[model samples]
Target: MRAGHCAPGWNVTSMKDIEHPIPVRIAYVGGGSLNWAPTLMADLAHDTRLDAEVRLYDLDPAAAERNARMGGRYAEVSNGTPARYRAVPSPREALEGADVVVVSILPGRFDDMAQDIGIPARYGIPQAVGDTVGPGGFVRAMRAIPMLAEIARAIGEHAPNAWVCNLTNPMSVLTGALHAAFPGIRAWGECHEVTKIRRQVAGIANADAGSDRWSFRDVEVNVLGINHFTFVDAISLGGRDMLPAYRAFAAANASGVNETVPGEDAEHDRYFGSKCLVKFDLYDRFGIPGAAGDRHLAEFLPVGDYLADPGRWGFGLTPVEYRTRDQARRRARAEALAAGEIAPVAKRSDEALIDQIVALAGGGTFVSNVNLPNRGQLAGIPEGAIVETNALFSGLGITPLVAGHLPEGLHDIIADHAARQSALLQAVMAGEGGALFPLFHEDPLVRHMPETEARRMFGEMIAATSAWLPENLKGAA
Candidate 1:
């Protein structure tokens, strides 16, 4: 990796230094998560600065137990990074006395997610990724909001002083739910869409300098807007402006990415793939960098703009069937790993979870783009509405940095979603769907359709995912 690409202004020592490795308890709400939970296990095993005891809890007790065993094995083989793992029977038991609570859960099964996308597509409305916005996102929020609220309530009762890091979808709504249900909860939503920009910038920095790879940590960005619809106005590396280089990169890749972006491999591109065609397109059109991946960004804009024909833009809607297949494949792999049929690998994730934890636990200061209630950090969004913007994480607490108002058009675009997300959070919090129809009817993706058709589509989407939804919402439209 290129020099100076490591953590910027990183303190070599913190309250808990190398020798001490302060002990902390992390309550993982979705401990059975095939993807994120393992990543966290590896991260904890790879870090020697803090001792982490992770309690895994999931609806599938057996899956959680499997992960617990895998985590124990992972820690044992990591040259001893100081950690422990266990599977808890309930959310409260897992959360009690925890120093940090991680919430990363699937609201329902893969089939449920399929319905989230399929029903909308039946209306000739295509969504590249349904977990964030569009009709699929709203339906997801319907269940996820209540589920997260329940988690938040448990945290309030069991780990009142713990820091919460949410990694669920419909990010804005879910994160807002935490605050809405328990206003005193210390929580923020973590998403990696903005990190993609930093990684791209790192690649550009490396290529421009004619050196080895540069760590994404070297790049600093100014983020604005909501989770899936975030934007980066400025990027800097080593006290040098990198936007010009980024602008050039965007221009070159605007039509199609002719080369592999830094760490990407063509063979592995399907499960997580994007040439950032949407990002480049946004830069070309709006004079701003779209921070989220093409699939996610497509859902936020007018449906016809990208989702209508995503393939034409060099990104295709990842079929739900593919995710289902991938999950099954991953499940098998996880079983093998947990059964000790294969060696458990320990590699730190590029995500900022560990760093954020360290920073929050009196480790040091770090900055990253995260979903938090707007506190004047984003200009056009209302205070207390969840918005994604850069924030400083340190011992004192999370402090959102100023992300000035966007151009009127951009501001209005982002503000519209922010308002909708906040409104949805309220509706879900109160367990009421009175405003659901209006919110669905007004979404950028649904607004273009005739009112009657939009209402029909909305009702069908709601009914498709109604099993977990509250009684008042099963027939919302």
Candidate 2:
């Protein structure tokens, strides 16, 4: 609602727009996605520039229908000429001749994710957000790769020219699999982990961090490493290096001591959580500012009981209860919207997917963290292995910036995982399900435990998830 925020269908006329309104067809692969679909719908409703159509497809018909209704309702209410939204039953129907394809699907059920987190915990290898790295990350890739390959093939046949912007978990691996599956597809993984960190940095420097409500355009940064495990190697504000100031703040807050006013404890303090004490610890050790939150960074840290009690690393476990609560909240929201008690609220969001699409279509430029093949952007990682780094998106294509080299200490950790990630992708694509076990053998957490125990736990997890595992992996054990 605020001025300067990208409005639904931003009508600003560029040379391209002046010539004729571009017809954009976006296919939402997981159109029933409870979290991401709605926000994207709202963004589309706010934009006034393009003549757009959004086709929603999902495994759950009712979920997709709900989103289609909500999306259409938002467009009707926003009073802006928004993208027409419709629910379709199949990927082929959704993806046919689309200009941009947004993939954000959960390959399996929520129960499977619970098993991913819980099975690892039984062995004392704790994971906070297990979708990205560690045993959970590898196993998740096993389940997700096949589904993604299917989507890639669908796109190749139906929307071959559409730009694929994946917002899925195990981002690097999933996105990498899509690239490998369809070598000619233009695809990249989009994540908000690094974006949130950028906002936090802006707050620390007293600089403007752009928001959906308020636009604060200029913020420059340099990033490196794989997803979940990334770092802000350089940050500048108005041509001034802000790293020293940011580091100074981190150093001062290293102890994470709370100074509360009489009777008011830290738990009652709303602003206490902003200081990332664990990341600062990493800064001291690795000499670069950590990009992700402590919860994600905890998975890769070489410390004891850090996974079991993430509190040991200054964070808490992401229990299954959290997901239960989230599901309940989503159901309630859906019900309320259906009953007309709540109308869709239209506002700009910080997500960069739509912005990237608009930029690519309108000949504008968009810069954000994108996951793609390394290709010398990171000297430490393999050339074609997926790596998350800063890049510029334009009509021509996404050009990853030269991030040079990661620090040797950090490089050693990322390189090890990157190699394993490559092996996991190869194994899954080749249907060599048994080969996945050795990749687990090299896992940092599994490496800490006894080999026999680790193998047993790994096999147990594989067996537990057999229902959803690809045909190749289903009977491997």
How do the predictions measure up, each by TM-score? 0.95, 0.89
Which whole-number lDDT from 0 to 100 does residue 401 have in model 1?
A: 75
Model 2 residue 211 lDDT score: 40
- Give model 2's TM-score versus the native structure: 0.89
For candidate 2, the per-residue lDDT at 229 reads 86
lDDT minimum window of 10 residues, candidate 2: 1-10
Best by TM-score: 1
lDDT of 1 by residue, 1-477 (tens): 111222363212233455567678999999999989888888887877778889999999999999998887788767546578899999988998999999999998888899888988888888877998888898898979989999999999999899999999989999999999889999999987776787788888898889965777667777888998988887777778888999888877656763233454554475357767877888877889888777888888888788777767777677888888778887997888888898876777777888888888888777777889988888868899999887778889987878777766878888888889889888877767778888987888988989899888887777778889888777677
Please give the lDDT score for candidate 2.
0.75
Error of 2 at 21 (Å): 5.4
Deviation of model 1 at 447, angstroms:
0.5
Q: Which ten residues in a row have the lowest lDDT in candidate 1?
A: 1-10
For every candidate structure, what is the RMSD over all alpha carbons to the true structure, in angstroms? Answer: 3.1, 5.6
